[model samples]
Target chain A: MSRVLSSKVALGGWIISSLALAAVVVLAWASPAWAGTTTPVLRLAAEVAPHDPGAVELLATLEQPREPVSSGRVSLGGVSVSFSVRVEEFSGAPLLALGTAKTDAAGIAMLTYRPTWTGRQAFVATATNEAGTSLGSATTTFIAKSSPQSFAGTVEAVRPDGAIGQAVAGVLLSIVALIWIVLLAVVVRVNLGLGPSRAAESSGLKS
Target chain B: MSKENPSIAEDHACDLGEEVTEPGELADVRASAMRPVLETPRWWWPAVLVLGAIVVLGIVAWVVQVADGLGVAGYNDRAFWSIYEADLVAFIGVSYGGAVVSAILRITKAAWRAPLTRIAEATALVTLPVGMLFIVPHLGSPWKIWELVWPPYWNLSSPILWDFFAVSTYLLATAVFFYLPLIPDLKIAQEWLDPNRPGLRSRACRRIYKALGGNWTGSAPQRRLLHGAIGLVAIMIIPMAVSVHSVLSFAFASSSRAGYLETIFPVYFVVAALYTGVALVVLSIAACRRLWHLEAFIHSRHFVRLGFVMVAFGAVYLYLTFTEYLIDGYSGTSGNAAWVHQVLLGRYWIPFWFYFVAAGVVPIVIMAFRRTRTARGAVVASGLVVFAMWVKRLVIVIPPATEPLVRSPLSAGGVLAGNWGTYHFTWVPISITVAATAAIPLLLLVLFRFVPILPIAEMEELAGPEERAESVAVPGLSSGDGFRPAAALGGRSLAASTSPPSAMGEEGGR
Candidate 1:
């Protein structure tokens, strides 16, 4: 009876240790796949090349890693990549959309940007698949030496010389001035009584 | 005339309870009108003291704000324009009542306007300055206010510059409108001063009255000149008031904000001003009637008629408000739609609903029924209208100012937005606003202490035989003898009472 019990206990311990080892092996094998599936970090790089006097060729490269089992394709293409620029260095400053382009067979997207401002410009590139799932994004900064034209600051006031505005203001101010003059005149006339009082005339006649 | 004979004066005093046989008599009109100026009521001192303390508190709050900065007043970058701006609009907006009652009614020669014009005009005269003073607190640095008017610092194209011009011009016009009809009344009051009184107060009153009255003897030429001047001013003031409020709306309308950039804003503001203006006039009339015991002159009919006018404007305002919301809401623009949604259903829902219920529904319900359209009812409605209008102004100002305009980069398809900022109410602004509100009655109370509450000359002038007969012939309404009560032509009275001579002459001379 003692020999039988010891054999049973040894069998049970062997089974438990084998099952735990197998589970560890499975989890170790699946962990990388799970991480890759959950967070698919794409390699995206944005490059700026000076084109015309005030224009630049914005190039975004969406690099995809090769699979161990190859699908026998030479290039990845047709992914929609968007380009944006932030001229201001402030974190709160908004990123203005430059434009969007599809990747070529070389896995590169290109856009011609005519910058209206010359400053420390930061460029951002984002890639998304056909299903609109974001693949990844990248940012690069460069000094824009020249602007297409004189950069008008964001703050704009109503110009006094705009034709319609000028005309309207003129008319309104004239009317205002006319009203003021008339009001003042009326007040002055009331103060002076305009003419002799009828009571004074009656008193004079009585005298 | 009563001063010539003590016995006759005593007889008039005794006949106070009985209806006077000659209501159109100048002496009787003068006596009734000048009662407030002559006598200081028991309640006056306490009311003044309380109101004055509040005004002092407001001034102290303002001083603290100036010392500490606008942050103490719950102002932030997101809520740059908030309570003080609304107060400015509301205070100025209520002043339009004076224009409506004094200018518009005078132009139309509305006979009932005679008794109410003084209160209306005086209200305008005081409240406009109070409203204009709001700009001081609003600017945060009032010392630089001169830059708004100074030519070198003037931004001609700025709506703020135009606002200052329009408001100052309107204030001038309001002053002229208030003073033009007061000449003959000044003369009447001057005549009432006792020659035997030996005091600086009496002498000062005489001199001031004489200076303001000029050489007016109620003669034909003086009346003609005065009438002509008043008519011109009345006509000019209407458009001036319209421009003032329109320009005021332009300050908001010109902004490229979701809720503010509406074409309907000018007309909307003008109508709101008229609506609130009439409501205030009704309230002032009710207060004067109750306090000074001028029920014989300002009957319940005045309240009802003014209530009707207020409701008419209220109806139009409601329509305009509906139209404003419907158009902006239907357009479905991201910003405007979001703002509208926020106002109707989001964070600002309480104030919006409060305004809708108090201003939009209750007043209409009150005015719709005859039983609820009494002096007390008008007072209730007017009070609600005034408070609700202030709330409406806040709704107009704050929501748009604090709306989130920037789009988040992480948003899918540019749909998701940032959080909307909030304007928290602080004690500083509340104190200042309450003070300004209290200042209205306080200033008016002080004003009436010098000038008659009623326009004595205008009332007597409008009290011709035909007018008096028409007034007297009205069913369920009667007054002291031949005196045509301001509301005689309007409708039936809810509460009417007359002041006897003894009450009128409680303290005849200062």
Candidate 2:
């Protein structure tokens, strides 16, 4: 009776230990996916502020909600952020790359963009890790009232007046005209027998 | 000038003694000059047909290009201007030789120029138009060429506009220059024709000649007027031709591209034109001499003299090329240095060395030695020079055009290491270029059928008392029944008599 009891205890302990080992193996295999699912989601926010006459300052904040914070702010430094702008309101309109900025210690990225035309402009800021994986993105809108006057005026001023070019062209045209006249006059003279006659001279002045 | 007169060979045996007059000698000149016009050789028709067929193929290719697009010609955004531009510069550049030979020689009163002048001037007359027509193929929409001349579409700042004005003016001057000399020869050609030949071709030829030369009587006053007019036109043409090539260079130099932006391009292009121009003249003279049996008139001395001229210009062009490369390379600006590298050591090295060997070194070598300084040597050197110069123009045009002016953000390298574009020539451009080349000889052959191959009156005038006196004492130059030897003519040799002994002595023996 004692031997049978000891054997039953051994068999029970072997089965229980095997079950524990299998459980440990399964857990080890699934831990990474579970950890990935539990990772903190990144969030982004974008804001625009008028800086200069034709330029506006863009600020984008990137934050991980579950990350440890210092002084009540999420510090997401060294992450690259790209800024884009779309003047068209349609859904399929392409986003033009405005510029790129990097997040600072305060988890905020800043860029200065000069608006070319007066309209409602939609801005997008995207955050990406070193491997170029997009972490998160944000969108914002701003209405520009008066188009920059100096920009238009400056472009117009930079255009050539063509004064000297026209003068040179005029002179060349005049010279070409003079050459044509001289050539034509000579041709006419040759046709009209207006020159001295070598034949008459050779004929002993016999007309 | 009668057709019943003995063949040039038989006529050579007759002894006029010391009493041979100018009229008798001039009659021989006229007979020899008009032979090609009066008699059609067996080879003439077949050659014309072949050349014409090639030209037709070029036209078909052009049509296909117009129907499709410039893509057929391997044109793209990167290689927008390539072969046709080179062709334009080259063809136009070759015409300068004719002007230099005819006009400059006329003004300088080089009497030896008489036999070659007609060939030279006719060459200019035909080639300038052909060169101008290259603009058609160069343009993406050739039909829009009218905009170039139309006033409202004119861009005053554009070098192309000035190029048009300059080239057109030069063309008019070329036509006038060609026509003024032909008046005297036209009279001779008309006198040679049978007044009552039954065929329409004969009648038409007579009528055309009559209309062109009816007013020309070769009177003293007419000669004076013609001479004065020719002199004035000759003087005008030199500057006009210079301006045409200068404006052509300006078309490149005005651009901000690396290889093209040099201030030296104008002088460089002008010298290249003169060099290649003389080469074409040599080739023309050689062809005429060989094909028409003008060996008696056009001699080895003429070739050697023209070869000397070619080498002088070649030396200048080579110097300019060296300086252009050195300055651009030494400065080491990204664009300029990259272009220089591309030409000298990179993708274009083959053509660059080809130019260096053919145009730069070989011709100089040919001109340097007495043994190789024959008509044959001149022709060989000229063929090489013409071909090589065309390649050099390509080197000048393509490298700068294919170079990447702006750097790409995606690329790791800067502008210096930027990707260079290539112009791959398809059959369209090659056919057109070959056809244009063939048109040169084809047109010359056909042209000489209507006009005298030699300037008969000019040769007569140039054969003065000293020449007439020498011609009588010299044995008949003909050996057997064919072309005569250059040496037998002795002091009567037109080139030997006129050219400085220093220049003609080495080649005069032949």
Candidate 3:
């Protein structure tokens, strides 16, 4: 009976140690220091104007993996050239898209983004190769608060401006329409000419 | 007054030399031209099967590429415009060559073009569709190709949209150009089809000929109307061909890249197309002469004439290349200098030098030497010109595209793999290109099986005075001042000689 109790005590001790080890691991993962240094992270920055709130600027930098408690900056240059990055609301509705921006030598991309809503937002950057194969992706979050501005200016800026641009567009379309019309006329004329029995019966050749 | 087999007709005419003036001889000439079309050769089936297989393989490869994206075809954003783009240009350029040469000959009233006109126009007809289809593979989303023609979605400023417009219109014009000339020949082919042999294939062939021919009764009014229409279309085709290659050049020249930012690119592209087009024509003539036993028709003199034209265009292209380089290279803008250096002295040196030597120098030498001005020599010269021009197009496209725009340092992976990256061709594109190469001969071989290899009507029109004497003697012929009524060289034909017995008897009755 004494030997059995001793064996039971040993089994209880093993269980207690395993539980303690798991708890320690969970604590380490949850800690800020461990979370910051454990994996490569994405750094996001927003440059917003107080008065002209529509012109919101978004910047994304892909950070490299690091050791815990280190304050040194990691090199992210050449990691993302012509990479796609997006700014969206926390609920996943996109507010701005910087379509395929040119990355600086230092691996930072300055994107021109106009935010629609004012609240917590997320920036997601995706890297891809020339073959359109995705390499890696990262995301970061930020908050946005802007002064009231009408959406009219944004709409105006999006459209082609000036009479010259409009005139060029008009002329090009007209030419295309004319070309199609002329081609159709040629077809109809050829088909009409090919009508049966148009040639003289005496010759027996109907050309 | 009796009809003789066409096989011996031409030989008898050539042997008799201005003596075979009987009306039955005309029927004989038509029969000779249609012999290859009517009689199937033992080798034809196997050839078709082989070419068909190659075409099928290419189709399968294209399907695979579409499903997996252009990445499966070795297309990266860095190498966005590569082999297929060059192929498109080359194929389209050759078609332009065929159309322009035939048109110019017709316009100039070069009578020797009789045997060649049909083949040249048919080349344009077959190739335009092939060239146009390359755009599908070139696009990232090929299924969205309808967006090009759909009016509302058209991008007015896009070079590609204009390319679509020019090519589609050009295709329509080419088809009409090809078809209008074919009407007379089709009528003649219908006459040759033996009603006794009522096989499915023969019946189908006869029906097609009649349908295409329409009501072409070789009467004076019909001939005049047809000639007028063809003349008008011929005048229009030249400008259309010019516009096609010019717009194609704009796609490159509009870009700010070093080699592409030249003012002379439009003319350069057009001249190159002309040079290569004429050379390909010479090559096609040689192939036809051997394959269809057209030695009696397309003689050594024809090759020499075509070679002269090819050489003329080659000379101009060489001059343009020099001028294009001298101005740009002298200015020494960093981009221009870098691109020029890359092509001339860097990685692309071999192809550049090959274009200069083979397309330029060798052809000039061949044309200069009287002994090497034979048909065989011309064929060799054309072969070199065609190959070298294709390489020249690659040199034109690749160097400007790959020249560094931003000059970022090398990375482990991504578009910025180096300070400037090169377009590396993989197996996928190579296979697809090979398949395209095989398609040309395959298409031509199959096309000629249905129609006479030579244009029967044009041949009769251009035949010697001896052969045309019988044709002119028919009743109700309204011969104008420019038109000859009979083989008589003088203003008026002798009344007795004008009434050939064969013209009044058997053929007139039919």
Candidate 4:
């Protein structure tokens, strides 16, 4: 049998790619988000719209669009008044649910996109492996705001500090999605068997 | 079976003498007439399908997790991290072993690695992702895992961010290490495969053969280059595993949490990972041996060698465990001591002790002694090691988390100062983890279906000059350490190989 496979250039490619991937990883650690401290120093605070002192705006910085950030960290002696937000069509798909899982489990979920499906975005929650499936899921509809001119351009709260703030939510949402997409792409690339050999693989099959 | 002669005493002394032969001869000697053992064991595929269904269930759970708020699971103010985080870390940590085996073998220049490196490397590649996926399951908004990329302060100081870096680096590195060596293997596969074989899978082998191996003919230039690349990556991998495990340990250490703050954590995690990783290699080797019918090539002696490595790491891990408790325990530091106490004597006592005995001591005994150091013993030891390491992760994560980071006196009740909450596993996290576990062998089987199981070039290299001769009729496995006298008695000249003997003793040896 003749020796038939050459290793020079391919080996070089493997070396280069492994190095490049590692470099990217080292770069990834340079930044951090949470302060690693447990002080919980008021992440988010907002002013109440409609101006009622009792009608509080979302209190926490990390607020879900439809869920209350915190149900008034104040003692409401007797009243069990709840808070909520409107769900509307955004990118064609109507809202499906209007609630948040526990804060530590899921900070928030969903985006309101306009879709051809006509049902008024009901929180169609089905039973999971758990009971009390109906304890959550409330239908939230948005108030229809007609366009000022014949041509309807999407306009609501534009200012960062307006009656409603869009910056943080949009920014945070985008960041999460961005990580997902990018990481997913990277994961796909790795799984699909791209680029050089490094130290260890999950399985040690010497080829 | 002779009790007088004591086969048990000879179990630990498996030695390969100077049976070094030409690559071609070894290939001809061991080559199977049939095809690759790419198909999963008959039961494995259906099990994977069941696993797939469970994974779908996890997806559905994720949908609920997304639909409802994050609170639907056991997340609360106190129990911010629950089973999901532990499962993620534990699974990822386990992958550390797979990577280390390949790196150690490559670094030590262990010729036996020819048959195992790609599998180990692929395991690391797959499990790291699965471990990383735990990050998704752990996250309230897995989408925010990207925030790791652009932290506001870009605090290079944080461990979690470092974890992100370390794991990704290791995974990428392992992938390349695994693929590069296979280039020649692919070429060999491309050449020998019958034309009648169906295309898709075999086609990738042929393509990979041409594209990567690039006219490799086992020429001196090609051999030197391949060996050179493997050597470099071997050295590179140990550091990568260190970095990965260190950062992982740092994730726990960076916090002031009592259980996680020990300086010993990084080293401890690294050793534990190696220990478990070696065990996995042994198990996998045994499995491949049986499933693929490679008994002639991979003898029980190989398991013994792997068992020896497992024991070495297991001993070190035990030492670290003691040090972890001793330094912290003797100091009487309330937080550290309390956490240790809880782990050793509290609710989690059983798991902690279980891991200690199983992962730590039992394997050493079996490995050290001849009576139980056979292939069967090694398999048991390996399975124990895997289970023990998993339990050890639990022991490591939960206790410290249960202790209070900040001391707040009990509120006029016996409820204690820190309400360091305990975590419970939910179906969602459990299913996800199971799905990942099942996917491992399945994906590997699929991969081997398309790729060669052993590094063809490396095997030829290991077999050396006699490989081309194709007439060196030596059955090395039968020549146990005391085979010299036997061969002389049998009137057959036997040259036992010496490579496996020397390398088997090193914890650092692959």
Task: State TM-scores per candidate.
Answer: 0.71, 0.70, 0.68, 0.62
- Candidate 1 residue B303 Cα shift, in angstroms, is 0.4
Candidates in order: C-alpha RMSD to true structure: 13.1, 15.0, 15.9, 25.2
Tell me which of candidates 2 and 3 scores higher on TM-score: 2
Model 4 Cα lDDT, one tens digit per residue, B1-510: 112223422432323222222232322311421135334357656755776776677777776665543445545434566566666766676676777787776665554455566656767776777778777767666666776658453334455666776677667667767766776555556556555657686566556656765444443444445556666666766877886787787778878877778788888888887887778777776665555544434545567777888899888888888888888878766676777777888788899999988988899999888888788889899999888788788777766665655454544332235445545555655666677776666666666666766554454445543431221233432333332221111111112222222111111112
Ranking by DockQ: 2, 1, 3, 4
| Highest TM-score against the true fold, candidate | 1
Model 2 spans with C-alpha error above 4 angstroms: A1-161, A194-207, B1-27, B408-417, B466-510
Task: Compare the candidates by lDDT and give the number of the best one.
Answer: 1
Residue-level lDDT tens digits of model 1 in B1-510: 233333333332321232322333323556667777777789999999999999999999999888756767877656778999999999999999877667877776666676789889988899999999999999877889898778767777778889898999999999998888888778767767676767776777788887787766665556778899999888888888888899999899999998999999999999999989999988887777667766556655567778888989999999999999999999887888899999999888999999889999999999899768676777889999999999999999999998876776776545426667667788999999999999999999988877777876677655545555665555433454322443331122211212321211111210
* Colliding residue pairs in candidate 1: B23-B483
Classify candidate 4 by CAPRI docking class: incorrect
- Tell me the DockQ of each model, to 2 decimals: 0.10, 0.11, 0.10, 0.01
**Which residues of candidate 4, in runs, are more than 4 Å off?**
A1-207, B1-34, B37-48, B69-73, B151-154, B405-420, B466-510
- For candidate 3 chain A, the 10 contiguous residues with the lowest summed lDDT are A82-91
Each candidate structure's count of clashing pairs: 1, 13, 9, 81
Could you tell me which 10 consecutive residues in candidate 1 chain B have the lowest summed lDDT?
A: B501-510
> What iRMS does model 2 reach?
12.5
What TM-score does the first chain of candidate 2 have?
Answer: 0.47
